[model samples]
Target: MPDNKTGPFLQGITRLLTDGTLGTTDIVESMHHRIVHPPLLPSTPIQHLITGIAGITYRNIKWSTRLIGKGIDKSLYKLAPFLGEIKDTPKKVALVSILNGILGDYLEINNNPLAIQMNLKNQDRDTSIDASSQACELRNVKGRILIMVHGSCGNDFQWNQEDHNHGIALAEKFDKTALFLNYNSGCHVSSNGKDLNKLLERLIYIWPVPVEEITIISHSMGGLVTRSAYHYGRLNDNGWIKHCSKMVFLGTPHHGAPLERIGNYLDTILHVIPYTTPISKLGKIRSAGITDLRYGHVVEEDWKDRDRFELSGDQRNIVPLPDGVECFAIAGITGKTSDKPSIRKSGDKMVSLNSALGIHKDPEKSLEFKKKNTWISEETTHSELLSNKYVFNKLASWMK
Candidate 1:
């Protein structure tokens, strides 16, 4: 039998090799087409020969890796019975979290073990926060619950940065139950949102005591997922929605992240150049989830039947903050003490100030957040927002 510990590693490597080989083939073929077809650039006979050879080599590698991958998969299956008993280490979980952020939808479709499943976890113990196991799972149940949602390529445990966990600290100070959500960051925001809605319903029903309030604190893409859940919960009339009292978005790209927009721009530019058009496909290789960030998509209608990486304008259906729930947004800037307008505009090096604060040129599309509800933190990067003292103080003030 294959070593259960090594099975996941081998399987993951095999999948990567297989996907890489196939991607290389596609890129080569695209290049070949562009070189030989309409709007083709002038090429010498030597260039034609080199392209031909490259295509053949790509195909050879594709077939070779696929065969090897199949063999590795077979070995993994033989050891599958024992795989269930093996617990994933923190490092493994972290790696999978990154993979999920990159190719999560593909992993799910392929039923890859690397795919992360959404679950509420007990931060004190490495266990699922199950309603049936509330007695042991939740040692202290409070009327007010605080849920922490991590960003793309993140897990619940990683919420603790710089030796401080905002969730735990806030929960302790406020006497609220703190739960962290672990989920595949690569899946569409709406998909995770719907799942979250159902999970909350179960949580509310099985709480040890009557639940009084629910407050969600989400960072980065996690914030989008929270909004999506709220939208769906309202539509389904889920009881959990009624208990939701507040939501705090830390560096959330309410309008969308600027980096994704830049990526989309590069992809469009590459496609326009015939010589480099094949390389453009690499830009499209990002998962549906990443592409969704281009417009902070929060519903199935926003992406269903559409090519996620297509060069198009913001097609996202504007999803305003849920009614009756107090919403707060935090924007972070990298500079320590810069008065330059550019420094403030370049928010957190990932999201823009306008997007994070839900400021839009169009009034109808802009989210109506009260001035007091929004914050801007200078000398803080996007990730630093997770543990910054100033941000923490603001969160505590809002919760209070």
Candidate 2:
């Protein structure tokens, strides 16, 4: 075998191109079919012939594309080992991460190489916790561990935005081991949550030192993943969950993000229309993870047996915060003060303040975090939460 470490990730582009071509052909052919046989219109033999010919041409194109895609895929694999393991640049990582966040579920279903596998970030590349050769990541490792989870389209490296990383800073300050989880954010939070639970189980079993405490600091969609993981931990009776002591959420959209709702609206509108219906495929391109954010779904019960794209109101059974864990929330706002909680635009541009704080109008849906445990940061954007000194201070204080 050759040293083709990059093959696992870069090969995804071939599959992506093939899929894109097929999908584009589908949309175009659908429009052609609709035009030739308009809704509620009579059909003719000429139209049938035209449509059949078009269909055959499209099928041939798709078949050829698939064949070529497979050929390139095999070639890349054979050629990869000789290329050696080309270290992934930050730019490439960001591109791949963003791609996964948008079409992760699709990539996963299709077995595309681009789909990011959930793993613990150790040194340069990610390594599974249960590997025989444990990662010598830290010295004098303690039971106090901090798990960092980044949001949609984000990777563990993103936690260190602009040369400062909350996970590293907190670990240094508190003398604990900080482990960053890198996962495909486009998968359903429930799936990622379950995976994280399993990873933690293995981590605890293989830890160099006895596990005593675990802290999770999450941002954006990452918070939802963390919440789901805790629920699974308890549901499966995973013993490692007992060590989870504190969870800090930064700009997490506990209720739902307005942007995804808007995207849902667009998908709905396009789908309902006749001409634009086919184009709605672009809207439906959103991953299951993004749709789960339609209502901050954190479990299988929340989305199973339902069309995720349907404009269903929040019918999900309200899940309260995980019990026995001191949960702290930090809602960043673009405004100077958080006096206007009801204002739609006061949130950190991505998450509304009320949603970030888990303040649903329905009493049953509210998470019930104490006032002292939550902080509202002003003049901050969602992306700024990672490196913001104030946010880090609040997280450190909560841990203390």
Candidate 3:
């Protein structure tokens, strides 16, 4: 649901604009300084004059933006109640989800109302707001439960694309309840994982029926979150894990995504030059969740006390498929089965085959799924996996 205080979104934008203005001023001043005094030269007195003036100007701009932002917040708060129910339309949800995926931690730290709070929903209705209310909503719920977890920058509704929804379809066919995990994809995956553990615990407690079996079908980053949730659930002895029977991962980067690695590379390369150093900050603007994808990080220990933007190699802790659970993985390729090594390596044009299959050069790092449990889809893109009939067929076979 869209927050009644839609003003924070405007405030967020205003704050970003203010930040951009200040950042631009600094970059321009730095360029001027570099031009005035080349790399090897000593600091000139002219440099100090330019630096001091820019500093004072930026300070005033900062002060002014702060005042303006406060005023906007006050006005928006006063006017929010009259705006009626701000609908979470598809387009609006997409834009906001994308924003959160890019600046989620930033939004949370700054208390931006646009930040998404994780929730579980059934048929577009929330189920975790309270136990009694959830019981009423899920009065006819079944014992078998199938949870659908969507990828980054995605909402649970995106699963219902092309007039087809795998979650609803599977639930209907198998006579089970379907729940969707909707969450901010920009926060640390571990934090979301822990939250998911608590959510599952509460969900089952308030469920109208005793959950006989729990199965999760996750995509991309959602897979990492599922794995992390299970890890925490096991450590905390959460009852939800005992009911978990199976997990199906669709195009999950169990190892890491090459795109984020490339982003990290660019961030590092640009940071080397004075002219482009400021530009490097733009690369670093991606969310903490994105940085986690660089190595499929899913635990706090993996990212704690570390500079996420540093051009670091894969230093992620090895997390394997959970024990006593049937784990399955699926990778999609945009080409035929007979495609070249390059095509195979570029699985789905987003995640690679090896990463999706949890295949690592180091044996210990590999997730070691049963060979028969993995499936590869040909001539398919990452987004198409959601609606692909062939993919659904394979998933159905596994579900059966």
Per-prediction TM-score to the true structure, in the order listed: 0.89, 0.94, 0.93
Model number with the top TM-score: 2
> For residues 40-84, what per-residue lDDT tens digits would candidate 2 score against the true structure?
889999999999999999999999998998898899887777666
The alpha-carbon deviation from the true structure for residue 191 of candidate 3, after best TM-score superposition, in angstroms, is 1.0
**What is the TM-score ranking, best to worst?**
2, 3, 1
RMSD in angstroms, all models? 3.2, 2.1, 2.5
TM-score (C-alpha) between model 1 and the true structure: 0.89
Ten-residue region with minimum lDDT total, candidate 1: 129-138
Question: Per-residue lDDT tens digits of candidate 1, residues 1-400?
Answer: 4455556655765787677778777787777767665473577787778777877876787788788888878888677657754466667678878888988888888877677778888767466754333443466689899999998888986788889999999999999989999888888999999988888888898788899999999999999999999999999999999999999999998888878989998998998886888898888768878988998888999999997777788877888889999999999988754568877888899999888999988888899999999999988989999889999999999999
Tens digit per residue, CA lDDT, model 3, 355-391: 9999999999999899999999999899899999998
Q: Which regions in candidate 3 have their CA more than 4 angstroms from the true location?
A: 1-37, 43-47, 126-136
Q: Which of the numbered candidates is closest to the native, going by highest lDDT?
A: 2
- Write the number of the candidate with greater TM-score, choosing between 2 and 3: 2
